[model samples]
Target: MDSDDLGLFGPGSVTWKVHEEPILIVAGLRSLYLQSLHPRAMAGVAQNSNYRSDAWGRLVRTATYVGTTIYGTTAEAEAAGLRVRRRHARLRATDLFTGEEFRVDDPELLRWVHVTEVESFLDTARRAGLPLTADEIDGYYTEQRRSAALVGLDPATVPGTAAEVADYYRRIRPELRMTREAAETALFLTAPPIPWKLSLPARIGLNLGPPRWAYFGIAGTALALLPAWARRMYGGLGLPTTALSADLSVRALRLTLATLPRRWREGPLQQAAKERAARLAGTPA
Candidate 1:
């Protein structure tokens, strides 16, 4: 790690604070739920993804990409992004609705994935008791356009603020739906196949009992955190109190995770980046 390199965000950036929170695990899942609602996005994943067979590996790789963008050196981040772009360049998905095979990496589909992802991170952090003001929230979105750019999106074409994201969602609502792909994806996320091997704590820890239900809780919490409108698309029309429950659940989840030792909570990438930031701050010209 280059102690002097602050990556894309540096220490002062809002993104550094927002993405560090453990609650963003829920946020990542929320983004998947939200992104799947787009027909093209769902089709792309349903057709091209191997998430079902390699669920944990897929999750780790996704997390690594996100962490690299936030914490790795600029070159590392760019390299990771380039790898993704090349992979996506080769993949195509056939959307039955469009009756055509389209590149999965199209800007429009990428934009939807990008927007929903950042929105979920911002929303989840705030709801889990992070103290971000309105301007900071806007700044987070503005800063994330750099992330959008790395994935081959034109920064100017992506939403740059919370207001813009909200408006974009409203305009795109008509195109969003719970298609067969999205439905199956959502079902799998709620109860994803667990890897047969697990340590002792994972088996009975978290007080959630079985591993399956434990993961279901995590997924359900993410589902609960979805915007009510998105929830409705998935037949989550039960009650208005779901919002309150989600808020409570997220807060509790964050609190529980916080109890663990720092090493347990913070991954190597995050720790290395923060150390670099601190090292640079302590040195003089």
Candidate 2:
């Protein structure tokens, strides 16, 4: 379904005022990436016939990341992380979440879905702590166009026309406030103005290519293992500082798995992995 159909938020709407706008936006973008990648890991979890019901249980937990990481206290965020992870472990390898039995096969539709989610994601990042500049926001839009190509959509056909693109933004305008002007203002207020600089290591980490063929499971493994020190190291290297947060780490796994190859990973494998992981950890299965 198109994000425009969600009607989740409104203009100038900040999910959590306590978190800086930029951080929240980044969090949102990260969340979108995870969502885009969900099918990958689903294979590792959907092994049982009842996988969908189990997955729904897990999503309810993962959704909490949006609340605790961006709005609640640190303790709350940490707690939520545990809850999501615990539920994730319950997924069955042979089963699928309640809805789709596979990742969307249409490349164009996937690209459009990715773009919409990324916009909302940036909105979340803005709320968390990103003091993005107009140039940076424009850059993000440009990059999304490129990313659309990665998933198999013609950039030229995307949005079809400037009017279409504008309409897309207008539809989500209610949930966002970091307009071209506001983003510019935030950038100007920072100690450094346009022509921003990112350290070499930071750039490397931030641009780290997507996972190998093992994306579905490995990403979740990496995220589940993410500790405060890991986040610090990644942050020190130049990724968004919030990327190190526990909530983000857990989410990274949840969404990545969802984007797996439909034939091999979509159903049973996804569920089995979740249950297997939980069993290994002796949590619950």
Candidate 3:
């Protein structure tokens, strides 16, 4: 049965190579930072997401969905996508800026989320010193259309190349803003409370140690890597070398993480997928 399922992205795909990096968490955070800049997008997340009240649970669920889509069997990936589509179809939010109602699953909004997400991942991977050429980077964007489709977007309408993505962002930039909701989201991300799901002792530990440092480091890196225009919206006309410093910091972070034991860093979904792939190849994982 394992042999029959390689998930949405097999081990050979650039998506797998990129998403498996321990540093993708920074990329994920960066996506949140970027996506929140869109007023309607921020409104949808603010209205429906439980990150404020159940931050840990929300994190786990989002991770599960992403892992399942990338590493679970093909059926698992499709099932996860179906669950997302159904959930989205039932949710609506008021656009505070426009005083209008908008569906969470609106293709335009979905497109915004998809682009920010894939772009952040690519950007973070590159900055973290991943050895990717321009062609491979573009290929990564093309490969992400499968992910965009999972959330009810038409793959044909989604940007499939790096140039297309940049052009899309250019066309959409005028609509982006730092709404109150966006600013609040950024503040919460910078210093999120310890996940309530942890034991009291665990929460206390998280508040004081490397766990805390890691989270802040990632948050800071995300903020540092924001485009200059984004920084201006957030009230900083950043220094000329902001981009260069962000790149250096990411490279340092990646090197630090590479020293950790693989078993301690790899998530179960990723490990399991690798095991399945090995089994299919008659080799050990």
Of the pair 1 and 2, which is ahead by lDDT? 1
Q: Is candidate 1 or candidate 3 better by lDDT?
A: 1
lDDT of 1 by residue, 1-285 (tens): 455778899889999989879889999999999999999898898898889999889999999999999999888889999999999999998988968999999999999999999999999999998999999999999999999999999999999988999999999999999898899989988877666565444677633347666778889889988988998999995467998898899999999988989898888888888888878888532
Over 4 Å off in model 3, which ranges? 196-214
Whole-model lDDT, model 3: 0.87
Q: Which candidate is the best by lDDT?
A: 1
Candidate 3 local lDDT, 146-235, one digit each (tens) = 998898999999999889998998999999988888899999988888764544767455445777787787798898888778878888
TM for every model, in the order presented, reads: 0.94, 0.28, 0.94
RMSD of each: 3.0, 22.4, 2.1
Candidate 2 lDDT by residue in tens digits, 1-285: 221211122122232221223223234323333332333332332232242334334443444444333333334444564554454445433313344444333443344455555554554444333456655555455544533443445766565333455575455333332233323322222212112243353456654233222333333323223223332322323244534453454445445434655453323322333344455466774
- Cα deviation of 169 in candidate 3 (Å)? 0.9
Candidate 2 lDDT at 271 equals 35
Displacement of residue 200 (Cα, Å) in model 1 is: 10
